[model samples]
Target: MLVPSKIQTMFAAFYVCLVFWCLDSAAGAELAPPRNVTMVTLNTQYTLCWDWDHTGNVTFTTQHIARYKLNSKKKSPIWSTVCKDILDRSCDLTLLNLYYLGIHVLRVRASVNGRHSDWVQKEFSPDKDAALGPPTNVILTPAGSDLEVTIFDPLSSNNSSMKELIPTLAYHIMYWERSVDSQASQTHQTLTSSINIVILPNLKPWTWYCVIVQSRYDYYNKGSNFTSPHCMQTEGATPWWEIFLYFLGSLVTCFLVMFPSVYSSFWCYKTLKATLFPSHQLPMHFKEFFGTSPGSDVPCLLTPESESELLCDNVTVRLEPAILEVHDLPPENLPAPLLGLKPGSSAQHSRHDSSSSGDSGVYSTGGRSNSQQPNTSQPIAGVIDCWNGLDAEQVKMQEMALVLNSRPKIPADEGIVDMCV
Candidate 1:
């Protein structure tokens, strides 16, 4: 009952040819060019991208399209257009591992069930660099807190010398994930030779992204070849308030660190000033006047006993009665007569014991000394009353006479006499 293997193979081939013929006849009825066709060179391969609007007789389904088979590269159909969900009418990687160094015809065809779309074709070259090798690795990853694309020089080796990694290379990187060549749109972001390199900071927290890098070394400078694309995702940023608080705390710490030095400087100034000028040192003139003026009086310097005897000296004592020989009717501008003495009005002779008193004891006792003048004068007939209300010249004469009587005798003009105040 088992069929022969050769017969089965023949039958299968016939059935496949019949299916192809039916598809060809149907495709001929609604053939049209594919819309929005474009080509991108990635390393040694070219990915021809486009969108079919299903405007033709064919509907947009994965099965309706065939893979790209450019004849010059000697590559088979790598992958049919099998993916859908086009974000902006774009497709990806219809050809890989098939790179023609120079221009080659690129084409795509579509089929619906038994029907086929017209062949849409263009010419392009996948050789981005003349130097041929496996693609250089483009590492796109989060560096610390930021997203960065790092290019590893194929010429660089762990054990090799650095001189091989020439600095003369120029790089170009282009990428579009959500939409092919999306930078062409208002939302599209482009990268060129001038701005092809990128480092991402202040990114959204805990988000992911896709990126690519391509490089070319200078042929004249002997630079390396182009690199493979890199894709990455990154976590976002910390709160702004956290950074502000950190700065504020640092300022406070700096102030605290300097506080002790500032305080010590002030302390040193106070100590130095105090040592140079003590608090209790007084002015020179103050000490001189108060300490010495009271001691200058000669009488204050005398002994108490000597002072008492001088006050009671008998020379002054003996004259106590005679000194008042002018015991007044009443003193005009002088004091009353000495105590225990008679007035001139008494006609009787009044006498007292010699021991009773003297002019010095009566007037100069109690330390007064003989400098004091008795106020009484002798009862001159008209002389006493005549001197009353006298002018300044007559008064001077009376004073002269009194001083002369107190002594034994003195010529009127002998001693210096001062009548002016």
Candidate 2:
């Protein structure tokens, strides 16, 4: 009985030890897998990363491993290890041999001691995943009435290897006017070769437009997120030449409107200046001779008989003797006596007097007697004869002198004349 009891106790202790070991092993295999796994690219290099969950009260001694397989193949895929026994949650996958345009399945697992958690799997394509990055150096420029947009390809760490994955790239563009009642429009364009320039036409002139762009591969309908909104304005419809012409026309119109008024003002100013300050005046000698006062009057005692005798001092003729001689003439010779001539001086006059002696003696200056009279009988007969023989200019000068001499002049005082004498 003692021996049997000993065997049973031994069995019970062994079984309990086995059961605890199994429970520890199972618990070790239940470590949480990597969370939030993501792929990041940086210029011909690729990296995989994940989050470490340390949220529970239980502590874990954890390590990571990453593996990949081609999803396109039907046969059992051979999984290649990207990283093993790594303390870091991230692994570099740039050294892995990848196929062009191949759909890939990637997995990451966390291990505690010798046991691993369930795998966290992700499906990836280098073409689609690499294009998730936004394009670089996007710019907008004005091209006449249109808008020109330029963008470079999105940067990728595995660009060289992924080039064959997406042989062609397509661009999706979205644009709209920045107005209250504007609607956005979209356009898609495919390019076999990389061309950074694009022209958008039929835009409103001088209007502000906002635009965004994204890239995608032809095989994959998925595209990258649109870039940050870029805003620019379209150029105006009017040409520079037409604007210059309008400015020139305005200048001409202004000149035309102002020229006449300017000229008229200048002319009026000149006339006013001339009227206010006269440039010419009469000589001082003439002013003194004419007397300063315009209304002065003086008595005249001298009568001039001819232009040459205007300023004579001596005067001995007697008007009474001449009148007495004129009254002595006979009534039959009265007509001839009035002309200061004796009767019967000529046969023509003597015949006229004899015929008119029996009739009343009525003298007529325009009769035949007057016509036949000699020019020497008048007081100024010699002067008249000399004037008639002169030229027209000399005749005019002589007549002007006679008129000036015939004016009544103020006589000098008798005492002053006597003193001169």
Candidate 2, residues 1-421, lDDT tens digits: the string is 9999999999999999999999998776567777898888543356778887764332222222223334336666666676776777787776764443555677887776566667887765564564354566579999977889898777544454223445566577777777655454434332322456888778888888787887765575656677898889898778789999999999999999999999999999999988997787657655555554354343333445545567668879864311000012234632322334344332111224565444232222121322343433335544445446557674543333332222233223321111100
Backbone clashes for every candidate come to 13, 4
Instruction: Compute each candidate's TM-score over C-alphas.
Output: 0.23, 0.40
Model 2 / residue 373 / CA error / Å: 99
- Superposed model 2: Cα runs more than 4 Å off: 1-45, 51-84, 95-97, 103-107, 113-124, 128-131, 158-165, 180-195, 237-421
lDDT per residue for candidate 1 within 153-226, as digits (tens), equals: 33322333222343334545544333345555523234434232356555454555555554544444322333
Model 1 lDDT-worst window of ten: 360-369
Indicate the residue-level lDDT of 203 in model 2: 84
- Reference-based lDDT, residue 49, model 1: 69
Which candidate comes out best when scored by TM-score? Answer: 2
* Prediction 1 TM-score vs. true: 0.23
Cand. 2 TM to true fold? 0.40
lDDT of 2 at 47: 72
